[model samples]
Target: MKYWNLKKINQSAFEKTGIVPRSMSKLFNRFKQELNPNAEVEALEEFKVAKYQTSTSIKYIIVLLITPILINQLSKISVLDPLVNHLWNKNSNYIFLNPSQEERAFADLQRFEEKLHFEILIGKLDALSAENVNNKMSNKALAIALEYSQESVNAIKNIIADFISIIIFVSIIITNKRQFSILKSFINELIYGLSDTAKAFLIILFTDIFVGFHSPHGWEIVIEAILRHFGLPESRDFIFIFISTFPVILDTIFKYWIFRYLNKISPSAVATYHNMNE
Candidate 1:
């Protein structure tokens, strides 16, 4: 006996009848399932699905939590570290994380010189010759440079470790299609199973946190931190432009999803969202 693909069968059936919306198709399936003759068999199938989804969720959590630390430890083994250092650290700049760090170092030196001059004017210390002032500034600048260079090296190590972790994550996702599908279904059910009020509350919370009036400040800080983590230049123009465009795009996509999918699947939740929003 040939196994039937119910999904494809449904698609073909719908096409024969006429183009039917997905929401209507889903409702029909739900009604059919409710009226199934083998109710015990349906319950057993649901139990199996729940079991698979739960196991997949646990595996995902373990992999996400442990993979990064395992990869980081593996990267630090004596065998690999020397080769990585030779290949990566050879050309990596040891002076600063980025040009911005150098600029900040100079700015700090300038501020120190200004403070020293102010102290002299106030007679807080004996007057120093220009040669002595130059020597002090040079020493301070060297100290700052050394400190920043060490920070740069540490940042590079972290970046390499994170890159490896990302590769492992992608590999797992690629290899585990069945688990991925189960997890996807689990997440969909988890979200759609919530009460209408719960859905509205979550939607409001997400929107307020991500794209609300107060979100630009949060985005600016996050962008600055990410740039610093990657030793990239924290350009004000780039940050401002991203903040202006990305949130608007995200908000648009979010609204479209609500209108296109959520509105069809759960009209009551959408209505509740609007009422609560008003």
Candidate 2:
């Protein structure tokens, strides 16, 4: 009596209908298995680490394009302008002259006093009232204070822009890392395991699913849901801040899970792939 071969029978079916049917069956099986926490964890551990190792030159280019926009938007915050102006006013000095002519006269006297006492006086004069000494100090102090205020405002704006840029840069990195992980998993199961002809056919299907789900527009809904959950205000600054920083938070959590759990099951594979180049 001849024994039947199950593997041969499956190969025959795969040959007859092509890899599409087999791939579809495998896809569904994987999907079902992924529904289980244990199976999902195991699958993540087995995920192809090599596929994700590549240059991030394109990612850096993307960051360069995006960081400027984030900085520009952050610089436009209304609060910054008012804070700068208010600080400028508070830190600046101004003489309170009663009449317009007296103000002009005080200005002339200030110039004369500065020219005459250039070598003698070491400090500025405060509150140059008509009855007070014409010590040219008020004008010098006002000029110095105004200069300092301008410098301080510019410094603050630069600091804030730099901070926002850093946040945006980190967010972009995290987003790219997550995308690489997804691509690796898809390639491992769908492309690496298939014949060349099967890979060609399935690549179209995979590309459609990957592009559709990974579009930035899809993130808007998730961002909105999170904002509503936290009862955050819907102001422009709040919205922009969320748009800039939320991806970093979300991707960090995802990477944390993969490293924390997946690393335990496949220690060697995980260790070798980390800090991968480009």
Candidate 3:
């Protein structure tokens, strides 16, 4: 608080000192580069796959999405959910499995590296979460640091949502040709962006109005209504999720089909990534 209140930026003094931290300045320059649609890393990282999923391929696109939403719904989940809080704690005070948390995270990520699609998503989320924690866990008070209005926290949340949307949209493109894995970190990402007000509101709304901790799970009631309307049994939660996936799946297909066709028709004008990594 003292530093935040006291540290004033003077335009002339800044010009004289030119004292931007190398690490902070790099991000600004990187963001400027990202304004280019053809930024080198973005192009390299995005690969177009012809065969996305198949009968023989893997099932499950990360069951972990539900976990964060639930963990996030809990009051003061900061103190309640250790793995998640530990995973999400915006500080570096904690260690994992005898190694630095980030190192442990990378090692944990190695298990899925063989699946190229899984590898990429894991890399993105783990790095995102760990970085979010590592940067703010020290010095700042947890309450203020976690405030939704706080820039650093908001940045991580926005990035997580953006990442999930990208993963979903991209997964749609590779439909039925291959199988990919999604990890827990994807959901953990959104927790960063919520404002203290937003989180408090959500905690109240989801608990009291929507889910009602004393009553049946909100998902159950919604599922029951839809299932009964369709003359299906209410017991089959999997059926509901399977059905829900169709829209997102098809939208992805249509989007990527458009992109692929465009690239095929006008490779020079539209294509930037080589479509295969070196």
Q: Per-residue lDDT tens digits of candidate 1, residues 1-278?
A: 01223332223323322255444676898888889898778667656656656676778868866987798768866435676557555765567767887887788888998999999999997899999989988898888877777666656776787788888888888887655655666677678778889999999999988999999999999998888777788799999999999989989988998987788767888999999999
Candidate structures ordered by TM-score, highest first: 1, 2, 3
Candidate 1 — worst ten consecutive residues by lDDT sum?
Answer: 1-10
Error (Å) of candidate 2 at residue 24 is 44
Scanning candidate 2 in windows of ten residues, the lowest lDDT window is 1-10
Candidate 2: stretches off by over 4 Å: 1-59, 65-79, 87-137, 178-278
Residue pairs with backbone overlap in model 2: 54-278, 55-278, 56-278, 125-137
RMSD of 2: 19.8
lDDT of 2: 0.49
What would you estimate as the lDDT of candidate 1? 0.76
lDDT of each: 0.76, 0.49, 0.38
Clashes of 2: 4
Mark the regions of model 3 whose C-alpha exceeds 4 Å error after superposition.
Answer: 1-190, 213-223, 233-278
Per-residue lDDT of candidate 2, residues 1-278 (tens digit): 01122222223323333334444666787888878769955555434232222223335555656776767566747556677567656845532212332344456656766664554454454434543444345665556445444544655555566567677767765777644443344434443455544433443343333333353455566665543333333354565566566656665664574456434433333343443311
| Predictions: Cα RMSD each | 5.4, 19.8, 28.5
Candidate whose TM-score is highest: 1
**Candidate 1 clashing pairs, residues 3+ apart or interchain:** none
